[model samples]
Target: MHGKFKGKHAIVTGGARSIGFEIARQFCAAGAMVSIFDYNQEALEIATTTLTNEGYRVNPFLVDVSDQLQVNLAVDRAEEIAPVDVLVNNAGICLVTPFLNIEAEEWQKTLDTNLSGAFYVAQRVCRYMARRGKGVVLNMSSKNGLDGEFGHAHYNSSKAGLILLTKTIALELAHLGIRANAVCPGYIRTAMNTEVDSDEFVEEFEDRYIPGGRVGKVTDIAPIFLFLASDDAEYINGQTFVLDGGQLAGQKPWKWLLEEIKL
Candidate 1:
């Protein structure tokens, strides 16, 4: 427990699996007491067991971040274990439906979870951090926040709001020694992404969209979160880091470029 983050405590929402899980693991590895807030009870149990077996301090709480009451209660429970020094608002959901086909409920659900949930957690945690005069908040934004995509209007809007929310938090919390930033990832190969896309589609996507020629893995993103949470990132605030493998650097004129090139 004598590492870079020794004596620190972190809460990672959606920390049961995928990117969130990796973030929690990295924090625990760095000697931080980590609490995982996830809606999936089974996944939470599994994650807790796995981390505990690995000799890491991990506490799992069943929390639906979209509900302020639940978030508040969860925070109370986590504080009993350790005062939160870092908060990663990584819980989010995406819907793939044509704009015309998107229902009001679906749109609300996306915003409720992605934007409002982040707000609730950050606001609650910053209150405590403000008292202590130090903390870090890392939000999981997306490449869609910078650029729109087809069939993802709701998802895009939520992430876009989150980026602004991160900036707002940074502005308001800086005086209290709190830093807020967003990480925008594109096409990360997570369970959620793989559920939506086939392997063939992913291969094609890497070839056409990702200049780096590979979809990003959870490992590729976890270290960045750790860096943002550490003291080394004291000056980095209100910034959005796009970990998209150059996918957003330029437009992909797939049809035109393919027609021009034999390969």
Candidate 2:
């Protein structure tokens, strides 16, 4: 119950599970009164109960960040606990559909949830931070955002847009004592990804993309996020951190690439 963020308040969208939950848990453990915003009532209940049982302070709100009204009202409610000191913009959804086959509804839903939702949450919470003249915003981007991935045109586009949104937030808000950044994670072992990717697919993905030879764990991501939330990262802003196990490092010619070249 004693750490760098003691007495601070953190708002984590999508905090009901996976990477978001880990971030909220760690923040709560570090003594931040964490407010979790998720659209899922069951998961939210489970997450809040888990933290409260562990002697951590946490509040839960069923918020769909894509809806501005929901975002605004939830922010107001969360502030009743305390002013927002940190915001982890993590609420997002991904549907695996081919680009040519993507529906208008699917495309809109992806952007609305992943990109616009992040915008709504950040805007609402940063206002609270701006008044205090200090706070942090951490947007959850993904490796897919920066690089091309098969079967995720909508998801990829939304995440890519988030990177720029994060940068713009930093540019405008840094002067107000707020810093914004994006975290781009690689093949992390989260339920969201696991549901879409098979066990064999995950192994193959690691063999081809991840140089670390294994998929990343939520543990690999939460610590870096908490770091960005800490005062130690005061000078770091408008930046993107990639935790991809060298997937994007442009490795030397592999079997497929060498065969394609056939020199």
Candidate 3:
């Protein structure tokens, strides 16, 4: 609660749960007024009510980030509540399917939600941030964004586009006093990972992958968002912070390599 983000107001897309929710939690803990936006009305209500009861100033907005009209309306509505000082484009979707078997509609949906959604939200939010002459933007990406995955062609491509979009947005908005950066995480343990967190999958994944001997937690990645959104990161922009616990340090798990090298 002692960071440079104190007293700022933020809009966190897809903040109903998972990494988005954790980001909102830390921001509020750091003394920022947070508005959580998500299309999931149930989770939105639950999150907002829970935070409100805890004495944090939180408002929930129900809107689909992928739709331009919805994005604009949500931003306008949020602006009415308070000027947006920071924006976290955390709303995105991921699906695993072979590249050859993926359908055109599914591919379009992946890009629309994962890549274009960030664009739509940023386009609207930055207008106000630009006028104010000082604001921050954080985009949620994945390690697959850097390295292509076998069954996640659509998701991987969208995230790759998002990373570049983040870089370009940073440059375009820098002159206006706005900062943009992307966070690329790997195998975070959130509700989104339930499908992969099963016993068999865990045995398969953590057995050979995740050199740290564990999957990542939402809390582990939350601070990066909090940092990028704060004045402490004023000089940091257009960069992607990877939070995979040495999963991408090299071709081999660096942790295991270190153990062997030490022995």
* Candidate 2, 27-54: lDDT as tens digits: 9888899999999999999999999999
Candidate 1: give the clashing pairs.
none
Q: How accurate is candidate 3 locally (lDDT)?
A: 0.88
Question: Once superposed on the true structure, which residue ranges of model 3 sit more than 4 Å away at CA?
Answer: 253-263
Candidate 2 residues lying further than 4 Å off, grouped into runs, are 252-263
User: Could you give the C-alpha RMSD of every candidate to the true structure, in order shown?
Assistant: 2.7, 3.4, 1.9
Pairs that clash in candidate 2: none
By the lDDT metric, which is better: model 1 or model 3?
1
Candidate 1's residue-wise lDDT over 183-250, tens digit each? 99998998888788999999999988987889999998999998988888889999999999999988
- C-alpha lDDT score of every prediction, in listed order: 0.93, 0.92, 0.88
Error of 2 at 97 (Å): 0.6
> Candidate 3 has what TM-score?
0.95
TM-score of 1: 0.95
**Model 3, 1-263: lDDT tens per residue?**
46556768999999999999999988988888998989999999989988888888998989988899988998999999889999999988888789999999999999999999899999999999999898899999999999888989999999999899999989998999999999999888788878655867865676577777788889999998887877678899999999987878855545656778753
